[model samples]
Target: MHLLIDQGNSRTKACLYKEGVFTDVVLSELTPTDWLSIKQGLIGSVAAAEQQQQLQSLLPASLAVRWLRSTAQAFGISNSYQQPEKLGVDRWLAILGAAALYPNQSLLVIDAGTAVTMDWLSADGVHAGGWILAGLHTQQRILVSATAQVEAAALSLHPLQPGTSTTAAVAEGAKAAVLGAVQQAIQLRRIERVVLTGGDGAFIQQQLNNNAVLLEPKLIFYGLARFIDNN
Candidate 1:
């Protein structure tokens, strides 16, 4: 059994895996006490370097823990980054899951969390790289910062239409920025599918007009699971 943790920007999620699947999942903050309580078990974390180091220090000296990273190549997919280490483990693992789950499919993997990322992978297993942008809340925050009038808390996931108020305007603008990028990518290529995941993945998917898009919130964990299986 292994304790798998993905310490993302906004929150930390941990899960238990045995054999090749997740037996349990616990989403919470990654704290000193949390990692300290695990007296025994193989632990793995895909997180920022600092958080990983802090947690490693709190673990029992005899226990085993490994920090996951993106290598030059693993699990059949080639990383597009010239320096593979510079690429994010979360994105790399998600690519692994996408390749494993949808073989020979051209895809655009969009993760919309604290930030919005769109990665393109060709049908023949080539990672064409990706783009990153401000997340919905982040966009609203930026707007609020730039102008003193509107409140950041006013934004919401309203329908994608003309903005009737300040809140609607900010919310729609943030969503449009993300969707516009995805739509442009879809228009530019013969993308077979768009796999949306992350904190606001479902909300973004709902506003999209295309049937090719899907919301798979647990995609990151599934990708992590693939990495663990190969090890």
Candidate 2:
């Protein structure tokens, strides 16, 4: 069995794979106890050592673990970025999955979690770099938290129409800004195969009309699994 772990800023995702296929998946708060439970029955695990000590304490001493890092190995894709190591592993894995799934097609992978990241990979297997921006909730919360004038009610994503009140207006505006930024990234890349994943992926996809492919949030885990399989 192979275990894939994605330790993101907000949550930790785990997937158990057997015989080259994913058998089960789970998401948990990045807590010591939760980590320990998920590590049981896994032969090996892969993740970034963001909280290395805490993670080490949770796993059995015999378990083999690997940390993901960007490299020049070119997993069937050409990384055009000047510094491949500077790319985030999460984004790298996501694009890898995109390339593997949609081979011979240009792709735009958008991850809308704590932050929105849009990465481009060409059909010829080239990593064309990407852009990052604040997510909808992140932007709204930052504005409200940084300023005393804004209220929490003003950031709700209710009714799709234009806001009738000041609070609604603020919330709607924030959402629009996030969507606009994502749209602009997709447009600038000019890639039709846009894959959306992350916390707000569904919402973002909805706002994007039919311009993108909405993928499950576990796309990164699948990518990591593919990497392990190929290696």
Candidate 3:
């Protein structure tokens, strides 16, 4: 079995894949200690350096862990960044995942987590760059923090229509901002397919109300596996 670890800002997702399919999945604040049954794995992380070190220290010495990073070019994907490594590993992996999942199609890949990110990949495998913005909760939190009078409770729903109350306004406005950004990105390029991943991906897609939008929650894991197989 191969363990695929996607360690993000708030949580760590671990999956066991064998024969091109995931057999088990776990989500936790830190890597679970009970994964000793696996012998090899790939880690695609956006956590702090210190945190990553802690993760490495906790892994079994017998387990082989390959850390995935961004590059100028890999597997026919040409990164557009002037300094490719400066790109976030998660975004790069998502782009790789999108390309591998839907080959020969212009794709706009969106990962909506603590922060919402959108990356574009051409059918020819060119990284057309992307945008990053505060996520739904982050936007609401910022508004609450930045202003004194905007007191509101946690949002129960996100409505595209104008909100009738303070809480609704805050919640809906954040959703509007994210949806607007997605629409803008789609207009900026000839996106043939729109793939959504991350925690808030489904929410974004639902708000957009587009049946064409795809939710691929396992995109990063697929990218990790593809990168490992190629290299």
Candidate 4:
């Protein structure tokens, strides 16, 4: 079994993959103890370069690690970024994963975890670029920190109707900011499907009403596998 790991801002998803198939998936916060105990025997692993370095430093010296990277074009998708390498590997992998899942289909891939990110992929596999906005928790913290009197609000999807309480108002604002972005992206292009992932993906999908949606939290790993295949 090959060790597969994807490290994100808050946690890392680890699993065993043999011949592109994953088994025994695990999720753990990026704690020292967590990294120190990774199973040593595995064919190899893939992750962001910086993350890979950090992971390797905590593993056996001979462990094989492959850094996931962004390319100008792959899996039929042409990246529109002027400097494709500047694009986040997570975003790049998400785009690759989306195109592979729905070839020839227009998509707005939204990952709403640490930050809310959306990448548009044309029907013919051209990445039209993407946007980054504060995620639910991030946005709430920003709002509360900026306004001394504003307190952190509980996350509950409330109606768009006017909020009567201070906490409710803040909650409503954060909801609007995120939900609005998702709605706008759906209407911005002839998006055939909205690919949602991340912590808030299900909430976004619930609010989307009548739109096709796919929730795959492990998209980056799948893309890593595909990228390894074609490159």
| lDDT value for model 1 | 0.74
Maximum-TM-score candidate: 3
**Better candidate by lDDT, 2 or 4:** 4
lDDT tens string, model 1, 1-231? 556666677776667666666655553443556455543343334456797666666455655566677888876688999999888777877777777778899998888888888889899888998888889898998898899788655445666777777877777888888788878877776789998888888887877856989777667767776655355
Consecutive 10-residue window with the lowest summed lDDT within model 2: 38-47
Tell me how candidate 4 scores on lDDT. 0.74
User: Which wins on lDDT, candidate 2 or candidate 3?
Assistant: 3
Q: State, as a TM-score between 0 and 1, how close model 1 is to the true structure.
A: 0.84
Model 3 misplacement above 4 A:
27-36, 152-158
* Model 1, residue pairs in steric clash: none
Q: Per-residue error at 179 for model 2, in Å?
A: 0.9
> 101-174 in candidate 3: lDDT tens per residue?
99999999999999999998999999988999999888998999998888555645445778788877888888
Q: What does the lDDT read for residue 155 in candidate 3?
A: 46
Better of 3 and 4 by lDDT: 3
lDDT of 2 by residue, 1-231 (tens): 566777777666667765567644543333455345443332222244556556556555655677676665456886666787777778887887777777889888888888889888888888888889888778777888888777645334343568777677667877888778877876786686788888888887666678456666667866777756453
Stretches of candidate 2 above 4 Å error? 24-50, 153-160, 229-231
